[model samples]
Target: MKTFKLLSPFVLLLILIVSCSSVSEPESAVNELQVSNSLTEVEVDSIASTLSLFPNGTQFSIAFISDTAVSFYGAHRIDDDLKNTDNHDRVFEIGSISKVLTSTLLAHAIHDSIIREDQTVRSALDIEMAGDPEFTFLQLANHTSGLPRLPGGYTLNFLWNMNNPYKNFDAQELKTYLKDDLIMPRDPGETHRYSNLGAGLLGLFLSELENSSYENLLQKKIFEPMDMSRSTTDREVIKDYLVTGLTKRGSSAKNWDMADLAGAGGVLSTAEDLSRFIQANFNPDDPVLSLQRDSTFQVNDSMDIAMGWFILNRDSGDRWYWHNGGTGGYRSSVVMDPEQKTGVVVLSNISAGHSEADKIDRLSFDLMKMHFAN
Candidate 1:
């Protein structure tokens, strides 16, 4: 979760603009851009202006969702290094942002009476554990499970394939690590250290509870229900609509395959699909979404961890729920203010490891902050 004191919107925007580093100048890129004609000139100008901040070969998509209107603006630096129209349906790997979906799956399990939020991993998986590790599903989703970011020997396993690190670590390997190499460095539910391993394990546990694959559960529980047709854990399914990812050094990169670790960072989705999911977060009538959005762990005065969302406390008392994603070649961000019914999602083919990757996060936050500024 991103942490900072809320300064006045004007001052904050000024600081963001001044302090931010930029992507190196793209190779002979021109200023040509495409804005959605549906947006008013001011809206188009305001939204499209940010496209200039991205890298040379960037395909940037922005979706602004509000109570009164929804607007999507997309642009790509084409073969000639001139900007042109992109599409909101173009899919990108939304890295740890997949944790939000994983957490929501946990919320759904509890909602359906399949498991209690406090159910232990050992109880769920029926495993005997060492070191008295008794972390609950809630702890896993909220990043307080004391699980390491990666499983034992994961570094050596993924060392050979940095671009597709989690591809080879299938369910059996994860199971083997859990049984033979499990270790807990911190007591469960005591602290909030981010843990990809914990989130992935929760996804695996849900598979045990539902007797289905994590990919199937997501389709059944989320994407299918929300009509996110372009969203899936299967990269093959999205290959046609998928945007090619770029490495930090601005070279072509491979899309990551999470295999069994799909819960941690496997989901791939588009702006149009994600807007539906974000809109659901604002629906008070939806019990599962309501449960997912509730605060489960207080990370600090400024931030609260919800099921799959991080609640950023604003000075105005309304909260902004957000999550950002990064894979080898792609970066994504989603943020919303339920009170004002406004939010932003930014999906870029730029590598999150890129020096300017935080620009995506800042762009989303700055756009969302503008809504509250009113």
Candidate 2:
């Protein structure tokens, strides 16, 4: 009986070991996809199913990439009369994502010894201002500038005729606003507030410093070097692939001309091109959009606002750097995990439907955990 009891315990131990091994073997054998080709059919299906939970008429293109690999998915409502052509290369206006590009260009300018972050805005531009002379370029780029979200005295007529009210305001007008009637929203650098006007002003300052058009500078410094062939500040380059812009709530789509605010929300891009850019950001050796610094700027504890990238901290303790864009009818997002060297870029033509960008962002994090969690 004693021998039998000992034998039974040993048998049970062996069985448990075998069972655990059996359970874990497949998971161990299942390789996690790299940045180059991480999203498989199963992954894509999962993402599509999650996205379908949103409303109809919504369109989105997503790309996931790791250090050396990439995978993508493109989806839209079937009943919506929209067609996906060159879906990978289809150019859509990336709204705030332009800020990321702009910030990258500014960083390049600093690398080339063109401008310094601590330099005052007055040093870069000859514009007059009514606010304090203490406002610096860093303040403007980081949204620490006390400048209002929009320049003072802007009228609806400006928006109607200009399509973008701030676009038509020239350096002379900006000077007037500063010199005659600028109002400080808050003390400079006291808090973080997003200001489209502040970013636009930085673009204007760069243009003035270079003594060239913003479009020309962006092409020569960023687009050409990065091989962003389809990315363009010029409307002419993307005119062919331009999807009509839509209102946030209405059916009628309008063409938003960035003639005035071109620097802030002007550049048009595709998922394929943006993915390449994001990869370059992760690995700066590519000679495209490189990260010159070891660390980017963090906004308190919530997000890291790098030169052009925003880092989001997940509940699972994972860090993701991302940015979203929305023009009239176009919406897009770019998310990346520098640690795993994995990232995702999503673009959409219709803006009124769902927060697909945010959804894709969370999904990217979840997928990373699913495939890579140890």
Candidate 3:
């Protein structure tokens, strides 16, 4: 969808049009994509070489991990500003990757018996829906909930403040939209259409069910348990360590505040912590974790919907469950093979155009393909 095209390109552009600074010289950085035949890195140098090409100096962190081992890399710096370099610990807005975490929360609620899989939107929240009343929580989690990608009134605010459209879209406004402006356009569970409103509303409903804030619920259920100490939904927490994202023209780009839509694309994280999050998905003790990856709906021949992940059928039937996120200036990606217990996490400060951002996404898949090929 064009909405996805505009927002979900997570990280560096592959094309040469944008100029960025290299954090370190190629020779000094780990420029190799291949580590071995079974888990070789492909075009790693090519990826590393483009590091400096980001006009605002890209700050990125990547990790490749399997059941047996892990490899990590980080480049944190401002373009052409050697004196102002940071490290992997610096935080970046993770954009929509927050969805995966929200889904994880949904899984936890199901696991804890706080919410039922059969619960419908009309019963869960204050929404006055005009469509199928039987639209279940399962449908919402898998994005089969017939809701539009955005609330009906979102377009005007988006046009008025492209940089920070959601800044004014707080909890009260979201409730207003749900009660007054919602109109179901498709039959629930008919097809897979991504909906930020649906996902964010799910978070809100879950939060109310738990009698706590979304951030607090996540902290108790996932972040603290997994030791993702640096991750947070509150912008104030990561403010000191946040990287400054840049625009196409190399000007400072505005960071977004998601207001009520925080569940959709509002969280800050680091690569190291995300790697741990992915690794935890393979832990057998975590039954709820697997629920997030369980197939919920079919999207197409190559893709399916799992709680919040896009399940791609790749490499002779291996499933690549992943999600990507982007806001005004930042983009992020996370992909993993639950079967292989292998995954990659990339976070960048620049939101290059779609083609470049897509290249960054492809590079992650390439990393996995190398492993599967062997």
Candidate 4:
């Protein structure tokens, strides 16, 4: 139990960006289904059945979309007493799904020749690692940068204030940590090890390259072009659009502020906005669309890491490039099947319990399966 406690926070962080992918479109594509198709009774039942297991008063929404069709469902509250099952457009912190957007910004950087896919961190930032290993932007984005999952002193901060571990972490603090405290868990580029610090650094470095804040870069390059009106990294904007986050014990929880680490996990968005982003992923003409799919590191036969997405290369040749996220009181997921031009977005404003990620993952995968398997 002591060990579990120490690891749970990391598990929460890991839950933030779970995804799958493929190199090319699947050999067999999904037939474009009609958008007007309503959720069948069985589908609704499946969602309810899953919700019944989580007693933590969840307010969740799911949006499943294909090339031509879309479907939505909401269990505005999971606890028995608070069955306010309305489908209002509520925004939740998207956790590390923000990484995908950060990486998309990197994609744009590559597209605009602002940066190269293989640009080194030392060359880009003029920083030194412990061993002076050459780490590339690709390594940082793909989690092979040898950086730990969190920064060196993150555990202490997390323990000091579990509610908002990143509240005080800023750019200068991060640079200080990088210079004196960072230690490579493995050789840079040796293997994939999910690192929030690496992703955060990638966002910072990209923003530096463009002479803008990560938030502004994403807003101008992604949110505006994608027309994601409700997506933003501002605490003020998030507060205005925010849904109340509930813990497993039914107590209100504080919203996360990513500060300088906004690139790592500082996004607040609605299901509708995320659905729009997913839909945009299908358009081949989108400049950075293909960049999201480009493989950065091969994890194994079962998975490959893309810029900010994970590619699950299945034996059947189907690919689901996806990512999931979790914060103190919110859980979110985004899954995309590039070949089928279909995807799913799930956002929830309640959390806790070690199984939070599994619950959301099961739901997201089931929705994706319903589209691809059927």
Top-lDDT structure, candidate number: 1
- Per-residue lDDT of model 2, residues 330-358, tens digit only: 66766777666666676776552334445
Task: State each model's CA lDDT, in order.
Answer: 0.75, 0.61, 0.70, 0.73
> For candidate 4, lDDT tens digit of each residue in 63-147?
7776555566667443253242434356888898999988888888888887788888788776655667788888888998888
Count of steric clashes across candidates, in order: 0, 14, 15, 11
Residue 91, candidate 1: Cα error in Å is 1.1
Report the lDDT tens digits of candidate 1 across residue range 1-374: 22212222222121000011101121111112222114343343344455444455777777776544455667665442424454678888889889999988888889889888788877877755566598999998889999888886666766577788888778788877777888887899889988889898888888977899998999888887777888998888878998889887668888888888889999999887787677666556567777888899999999999887889998879899999999889888999987666778889888877887887787788767664355
Maximum-TM-score candidate: 4
lDDT of 4 at 278: 75
Could you give me the TM-score of model 2 versus the true structure?
Answer: 0.77
Q: Which stretches of candidate 2 lie over 4 Å from their true place?
A: 1-42, 49-57, 80-86, 153-167, 170-172, 249-252, 284-298, 315-317, 352-374
The runs of at least 3 residues in candidate 4 whose Cα sits more than 4 Å from the true structure, single-residue gaps closed, are: 1-34, 78-88, 352-354
TM-score winner, 1 or 4: 4
TM-score of 4: 0.87
lDDT of 3 by residue, 1-374 (tens): 11111111122211111111111121211222233222222434434544444654666666665544445555544435312132456788888888888888888888878778778756766666444355777787889988888888566767677687677677787877766677877878888889988888777778877789999988888788766778898878888988887665556788888887888888899876786677677554557887778898888899988999999987488888988888778777889987776788777777744336666676677666664454
Top-down TM-score ranking: 4, 1, 3, 2
Candidate 4: Cα lDDT at 354: 36
